[model samples]
Target: MAIDLLKRVDEIQAIGAVPKILETVAAMTGLGFVCIAHVTDDAWVTCAVLDRLAFGLKPGDELDVTTTLCEEVRDTARSVIIDHVAESTQYAGHHTPRIYGFQSYFSIPVFRADGRYFGTLCGLDPKPIKLSDPVTVSTLHLFAELISKQLDAENRQQAARSDLSSERETAELREQFIAVLGHDLRTPLGSIALGADLLALKVADPALLPVVERIRRSARRMASLVDDVMDFTRGRMGSGIRLNLRRHDSVHLTLEQVIDEMRGLHPERVIAASIPDLLCLDCDPERLAQLLSNLLANALVHGNAGTPVHIDARQQDGKFVLSVSNEGQDLAPEIIGQLFKPYWRAASRSGSEGLGLGLYIVDQIARAHGGKIDVTSSAGRTAFTFTLDNVRPVST
Candidate 1:
């Protein structure tokens, strides 16, 4: 009977005439009437009904949904039938027979596809009758199953819409963040460039030259931060940037270029570098140069003035480890974890010149090249180490 009702409900849903079909089913069953009631607040409300003999009852009627019969079906997780409403002890005080003039009632619990109870499909009659027919009971049960399937389908559609909304919100936030980054970086960068250009024209004051160089270095740092933000955005959007990889001397050429740039800007600070002569690696040269420049600049800005900043490169365990160390205050353990996160600055630093994107860019570059980067700091020294693929041949 349950399977048959489910099949009928499917047919009703396909036609989008469940109310008409339900009414027809009730009238034809000869049980005085039939009703499809939805459970709400432990009470039954008529959603659809079939009554042709002017029984005075209509659709959208409410009844005691929490009565013994309904509660019994729900609690026992099965169907219930009251053949004679007056004689049945369970239906004595129920409002069905007393108020609505219903003497015979048969109700099957409706369940969703996941087997959660949703409501009930019931048949009613004013005249006393026996509800012992197996075929009738089975049909009602089947109808309940059909209702469950429709409910399941609607729930799935709602969930899909919710997911789509969440995705749209995420995209909007990303766009807003990018817009703010562009706005913040433009003004400082322009000021730094203009200041450096003006300083280049004057040669009389030696002290002013150092200040001018600082402005230029700071401007370059801001530009690098902007680039990192753009790259990270591109990566998140699934448009992977193409790496311009080339064979280059890892230690000799790259470090020399980086050190030369830093030295030209920081003439007073001693920068020491030791790189092996013939070590070569396949990597994006521009990215490696930027990485080194960022590390060196960070050391100059944060490390103690006049203290030597050391750059070391060597092959260790079939990988090339490049390290930059300088004399600086030790960083707290908590700060180290967030060092590679964008826009995160250490508490010890002041004068927010860059967008804290240096270490983050280094991390991204290393990961893209199948490598890694890490740092160690103490009271007197801080070091950043990065690794790249060792493309050099092993000597016998």
Candidate 2:
């Protein structure tokens, strides 16, 4: 019998006409209040109902699933009758009859085809009645099966939507990754080729050795960028990245490393640092280095080369505050708001050769470490600041 009920439910779902089926069920049942509730451990919560004569019961009301008559039928694996609540030991003091102004009630257990109990299909009346008529009870049971079918169909549709959304997002990320890879790879490859050509020409000048070193540094940076991109992708897809947390002089060491790299690109710029050597933080050293490098590079590319770029890191109130400021024309309000959005670059610099993923990646890395990034721009200066927890000062 349960198998037949489940088969009927499948047929109802296959029809794919929820509203029409519900209307039909209401008319066929001819009951004052007809409801379907799904059983949970503690309650039978209403999922759908046709209460044309609204008796204040809503779609999500919960009744005790363990003790309710509907549950008893499900547990005993048979239908029970309550001819009149005032005469039954099981329901004499029950609230359902008095609150809904009903003297008679009939409920049938809803079950999966396998006879696994789910909830009930119930009907109520304001006067004494006999709903035990075989046809009425069977029809209500069939309607319950149909409700189960509707829920199953809805779940399948939602799963399809989720799958499609995931695919679309993956496709987009692949496109962005390809673009960044091409741009980053070209520069290092070009430098290595140029250096090889120079060496082949027997240009043995001592000054040329620096050029070879420069090529090697660029190649390493490119490799690091690739690794960062891979780690970021994994993290975004719900995988955790390993974080090496240790107390190290964060401000002094991180800023020094960043300044050294930026000076190689923009020797004319005055990059100033005001960081305490003793300020320490618990962070992944490599990720922090990448974050600072991105910020410094952004400043050099967008800000005036001759003006000063200021970096400061300090320990205050158990947090490490780091800021990078540059003397540049203030960023437009609209651009500042979306600075960290992936693939977002200022419209004014439309011709710049950037994939615009740097700031976005930095923001993600910061968030993964339980920190936040913020920016302020006005008049002649723009500053980006971030704070990290568990900051302390190192002892000499």
Candidate 3:
């Protein structure tokens, strides 16, 4: 139980919202001490703590189970609230309050999403205060639920990573887990994005706005990661990527929007896009736009900083061909084919810009549209081109 508890604590601590959640809990409760404790039959260990009173409890700190009130909460699988430890006739005889020397204390039992009793979200203050309020209880409960779901996500992700490494044995399980984690991530991510928006509008602290913006950016990156993983799972474990192909006369505009957005993100970089023939194609407009985005982003990430990336979408021989070209160190002849393979990262990529699935997803999108993607590198210039014929299928 302690091993699992420590693992879960590590998982939840990896999540970005944990710090905010603990801070908000302390602020809302007006308590000098708040903690998430992992309680077993014999030991109570702090998973996380916020101590304004110099309580000296860090993650993994252990306390005597008999000396902590959470032991009772764990045993009963219910919350314990003591508004005034000295005034409560029931608690006057209890040793925990006297041992801890706290006048007010509350603990809400926390459970895993699978309904296994896990721990407690508990807080205490030296002076007596009103603790049985509706808002406080509800907030703690909601935060507990959120923490549980976040822990579940982290556990799933960890398993997926493990399975990914031992590909031959656990590939199938990894695919299923990745699919589940990808879909399940959307709700909590949406909540975090919404919370960031609320912070932007409600909080006026000049220094804190950047932190909120970082949260918002991190959330967006997480959403992209989820999408990439989902695509890889579907393309690998199931059939190839299915598409909703449709004829669009204004597909050029969609590509333009993608370029504009990319430029806004990296304004100092130059990206030139031209679709002179007024693109009209029987393809998935959105997926085609995604392919272009992936290619352009790759170019920006690996291309020479002083050079401009060029993108051209053209109608040729009754087929739509889109090409992205960038000046960079020419990739070797051997490495070009692996660019579209799942999780294959080029050695030239300097940072963790992606899991190398961007190009793979782009390839899948192309194939879903009854098309093919190609790449060429020569004389320090690398270009990726995608082509779909006019005889596109109506549906997948």
Candidate 4:
């Protein structure tokens, strides 16, 4: 059978305040037994208790509703106080006092924040004490009010947490949708690029050649933009950029390929590259190509038009280092701090410069290889550098 949910709810509401309240009940009233209880028609359950007399009562323990004095307070919705149960006319013959063997009894009906009667905060002792005193009864009343306020605050906090959980789930769904859409668009984009290449061969007219070339260039640019979008979605929605590192005979081949592709796209811009093979790379080839491509594009657009963009890849000691340098005005310190943040673009550049995910993707790729990216710009010379561990990947 399922547990009694109402009893469990009462236990939760009393978690923090009940312990202090029970302690206060005994210290102020001089009662040997002090407890917070949940009384209903069928059961009387202990929420919390200070059992100085070895009462053996703890939270969730139950007594028959018919046998406890708390049940009378629950039914009448009033306090029950007998300074000396043996001398009082009302409780002298009462079986509850005789059964529990208590001479002094004190119990007050406790209400919830919503003004509904919940149970009782009760205390009892074998010896008769000053329960009839006004100061003692008022102290019990204040504690019951304090417990009600605490329970109300807890309920509000729980509701806010539930709302936040729902919002997080919704955000995850939106990220998935963006990733799926980016993947689906790639097939059609590939067809556009292929069709441009086919038309260049068929249309031999010199006048139409430039138009075909433009189509090819536009298609290539669109593909690059698609790549940026995919990386952004992955970094935000997924864990990070995944890597498939392998030991290559030479890493120079991929860096040279990227330089050649950059030259093809921007032939007018001067390019100088140095790739002296010093170490074999244990890295992801495709991701490395993408990393260099982003750096080259940034250099060609932002660097001085007449100066050459320098690309260098070499092994320094045991670590592999790849760097790209160019002539440019020094970037502000504030801008450098945000260089690897996604979608953070320079205000001087146009929107057509693409979503500013290039450096962020480059940073993620380097980190996947247990490497880091560093950049410095000053005195008309700016360089972006990447350092990789150049170690072999152990097979899983």
Q: What would the TM-score be for candidate 1 when compared with the true structure?
A: 0.48
- lDDT by residue (1-396, candidate 3, tens digit) is 467767756765665445545655664455789888877888788888777878888888889888988888888988888889888989978998888888988998888768888888889989887677664566577667766766666566656765655543344654565477557657766886798899999988899898788768866776676677678778878677767777787787988999999999889999988876456777777777778888898899889999999998877667778899999898887799788877677666634455568899998898888789899999999999988787432231
Candidate 3 to native Cα RMSD, angstroms: 10.7
TM-score of 3: 0.58
Ranking by TM-score: 3, 4, 2, 1
TM-score of each: 0.48, 0.49, 0.58, 0.57
In model 4, where is the ten-residue run with the lowest total lDDT?
12-21
In model 4, what are the clashing residue pairs, if there are any?
Answer: none
The alpha-carbon lDDT assigned to residue 359 of candidate 4 equals 89
Residue-by-residue lDDT tens digits, candidate 4, 35-121: 877777787877777777887877778887888888889888888998898789888998898888999988898787788877788
Residues 302-387, candidate 2: write the lDDT tens digits: 88878888888878778878888888788877888899875567766554433465787778778877889999998899998888
lDDT of each: 0.67, 0.63, 0.77, 0.76
Question: lDDT winner among the candidates?
Answer: 3
lDDT for residue 347 in candidate 1, whole number 0-100 = 73
Largest TM-score belongs to which candidate? Answer: 3
